[model samples]
Target: MVQNLTKRASPHNVNDRKEVLSGSCIEATASEIIQESNENMTVADAVAQMFENLGVKSAYGVSGGAMASLWGALSNSDIDVLNFRHEAGAAFAATEGYFASGNPTVVFTTAGPGITNALTGLFAARGEGAKVILLSACTSAPQRGRWAIQETSTDTLPSSGIFTTGTVFNYASTVESAAQLPQIFRKLAVGMSQPGGYVAHLTIPTAVQNMLMDETQLPEQGVSCSLVTADAQVVGNVAKLLRSGTFAIWLGFGARGAASEIRQLAEKTGAAVMCSPRGKGIFPENHPQFIGVTGLGGHGSVMTYMQEQAPVRTLVLGSRLSEPTSFWNQEMVPSEGFIHVDVDANVPGVAYPHAETIGIVSDVKAFVLQLLDILEAEEISESQLKASQPSSLPKPERSPVEAGSESLIRPEILMEAIQKVIVDGTDAVVMAECGNSFTWSTNLLRFSQANRYRVSTGVGAMGHAVTGVVGAAQARDGIAVAIVGDGAMLMNNEISTAVKYQIPAIWIVLNDARYNMCHQGMKMLGMTGADAIIPETNFEMIARGMGAKGIRVTKESEITAALETAIAANGPIIIDVLIDPDRPAPSKGRNKGLASQGVKSTSEQKPKVQASFPNI
Candidate 1:
């Protein structure tokens, strides 16, 4: 039987659940609001207002004595604050919330160790081009230089260089002048809204937060500036290139707003489309001109086409073409000329040093619209546009399957199953774990306008998916799914958080019972030993211990049934599928490097082989 929670107990209570307030509630009347007008609100109140203005319905963070005031503010607001198991999980969930809804979200942490643990998500956000604000409470101002518990030098925070190229700023140290907060927050918002990315670290000292503010001194609401525009000459040059050369468009996370326009431009110009991992859902992968993802862990055909015969001009929009996309090698793009359109001018040519690149600082959608206008002014013939379409290249043969062997379920199959279930119409979000799971999901998932997918591409942090789902689900008010691996799931105990909040999330744990990727590396090093093997534990039992429903499956036929049952469950559910431990997913470019090492070992052991084959 389900117990109906009261509104007071669970302020976030939905589904007629009982409300249980962990603390006393403070009511605010019109007179109290007017009285507090001049003063800087408490850290908790300020945080609550910030999230409310950002359109965040819910937020996730770890709570402690340091952040109690902020927690009070969050609880007072309509936003539900989920207490996570780790600070990293809280930060990752905040990033995922932004990815899912395009709305700014908050991640709260206490000073010192909590802030340190949360930095990984900040780096991930910077790398993946996500806009996220991390709210952290610091030790009281009086505790400075006294070696107070959980104290650290506040000055050292900015020097971390996480937002080196992008915008990085700190909140005001004192709130005695409440008039400064709005402007400071506006600047932070503008920085985040800028094309590249931004990380605003707001630290509130305990002493300043406890002070009462005089009414009428409060700051005004914040405002953001428009995107910078490109020069006319640059637009003309881009138009000329688009008209003359066969081009392909490479998009990144920052290009989300111009997805439809990008697709239209591709269709109009007869160009092929590719995207970074963060840009997975920006382009419809099923479209004829879509060439799949490019970079490390990308499809082989897409890389071959980009390198060999596809196009002479590459238009990189909203993408920095960072390391893994360039295969950590500078010579990835052999094009004569490259055009990079980003909100930030500094992002281009940073990763690719020697390229002849043109940088345009403008909003991606507005710039593309202007370029389309320029193309129309040129009056290029329809025949000329038709001529830009290259003849279809022959599709490569599928990798050969070993005969008389068990039919192994590939990652593509898993993507297909989810795609079939959700279809293209639903507003669904997929949170994928790091490693090969990321590669497979990014490569195979067919992204639609309504569907969003998130991964920790920047920090490449493991165990991000499970916690990310909690935040994403809260933001969307829809069911969330996490596609994770057994290794990653163990690293972060996310089950506790899920049960505590009663968040109904579906976790698909691909259990292979080993550190498979590392094991593959060990095998390539002529070490056929299985020391890295992890014992198969009952993941379902683990979930049950945390007060959630759990399902275990060993055969392929059981996947669908388990998934259906898990999704229908009223609370959080974990489905642990026992995949084949021996069969690892094949990578395109990685095999050659391993094979070369294997060849050297074979040569060194040539004598043993001959001795064993003496009868032959």
Candidate 2:
């Protein structure tokens, strides 16, 4: 589907094609070739060509009149432009799509409300570390300060974070002329080539988008960059440090690509491995050395390991060890501080400022490879390290919950079925939405590989996974199941979008009829008079009304059959499980953190504790 202008030989478009030779045709750019072929090409077309060259395969957005030309250009290009229900949903989908596809995805919006609506999802993208570009339209220069319709001028909106390079956007620019196209494209290309997540913004005015571009003005088609790598001496020092004392591996989502090397490193050092919630699948969760996840619905075994058989120093891999992961827990700190390796140099010591940290700015995979080389060169075998390590590391507790004769299903039983039918049986990507859904899934399901389990611990947006599953399914070209609560399912579900695209995205809604996390969390903190209840909703009916399949599950025994059916369905499906409202999710740590932060708690009312199992 790559449209080559040089090869277009149709009679009607014959005038559009021309041959241009520059200095014996030795160094002519693709843009120059295109300029020679199509003299009447607009700025939109030029930008589209640049996106094609830059490896952007898809764009998600809600189309508007302002961006009509740009939309047309993208539609004509190889990039798949998906018209979503809402701008925020589109942005969320784009975020997940970027992660699933490993490509810089685009989220397009038109003026004012369109631009503002997508900000939350864009923030999520920035926090989760994904490459997403927001292509929007702004008020034309002549129309600025005037009473223009949906005027997206500086007078109307704050330009600091949205239109400038700062926390939100890695790069931002307004294309005022066709001449800026090349430089803009170059910046985008260069930015996308760098490590870690990059969220950018490019707003083109309506007038400029349709303006005829000159032959000399076209987007640049070439840009290249290299991955960050640690210095040889630094790698050697890290290896020596690891060899000198006991160290545990603390993983974050950033270390996802280094799973193989991480496994080797863990086995070689006989280190107990723990992960953040987002880092679920990066290391094999079922491995003997694996302790458990770290924060927010994290396992108690990790605390036990840190308390009882504390390592001399912890090897932090690509994680900031932020509040969500560690809650700044003092016990998790090692005796000799941490050797934190991350792509971002600033991430290491920022979370726990008091803790001594040796930060290495390099790709996790690259750093691990070099460290492995040093260990191998010194002939540091597993047998040598095993004697000093714990004879038995604590593993995550997995309590068995029977399918009791309760009218409403238990969340634990639901997760068990999902683990059996979807997580284990199929190759679907499982995502858990924020709230109790996040806690339940993080505490229950186990993944053995990277990219299989995804959760937004960064921003922890409510409706993210509910709508993002569509993008993941489409980008991955496979089944993507979203474990979401009824609140999220109702707030934002892309069943219609999935139906439009014929994507078989699935949602397992914990239909508890309330914001259960807020409900339970408030109760656990002993706060009163806060209403988190919602009128009971049937997500199955909503899904069916949206032209998708649906199944309602009211009892624990119905979960497996419902999940199996949904997984086998050819189109979008929803499984609405009416979960029990009284069961407390494994969120005691979060409640405890809230209590420490001056939240009120009653001494008489103790929160219901989840049952724990014996260590394996």
Q: Please give the clash total of every predicted structure, in order.
A: 19, 0
What's the lDDT for candidate 2? 0.84
Scored against the true structure, residue 142 in model 2 reaches a CA lDDT of 95
**lDDT of every predicted structure (CA atoms):** 0.65, 0.84
User: What is candidate 1's TM-score against the reference?
Assistant: 0.84
Residue-level error in angstroms, candidate 2, position 433: 0.5
How far residue 367's Cα lies from its native spot in candidate 2, in Å, is 0.6
Candidate 1 residue runs with Cα over 4 Å from true position: 1-33, 36-43, 54-56, 153-183, 328-331, 393-413, 422-426, 525-531, 589-616
- Candidate 2 residue lDDT tens string, 1-616: 1112222221112222222233345555666655544676778877777787788988999989888888877876667888899999999999999988899999999999999999999999999999999999999999998978899988999999999999999999999988888788888888888889999999999999988777545444567878899999999998888878788999999999999999998998899899999999899999999999988888878877887899999999999887778877667889999999999988988888898889999999999999988889988667986667888999998876764885888888888889999988988899999988888999899999898999998898989999899889988888999999999988977788899888879999999899988887666555689999999997878888889999999877788888888877888999989989999888644444434444434445443332111000
Provide TM-scores for the models: 0.84, 0.92
lDDT of 1: 0.65
* Residues 334-404, model 1: lDDT tens digits: 46667888887778877777888787888888888888877778787656774866756322223543332
Model 2, total clashes: 0
Clashing residue pairs in candidate 2 are: none
Give the per-residue Cα lDDT of candidate 2 at 71: 81
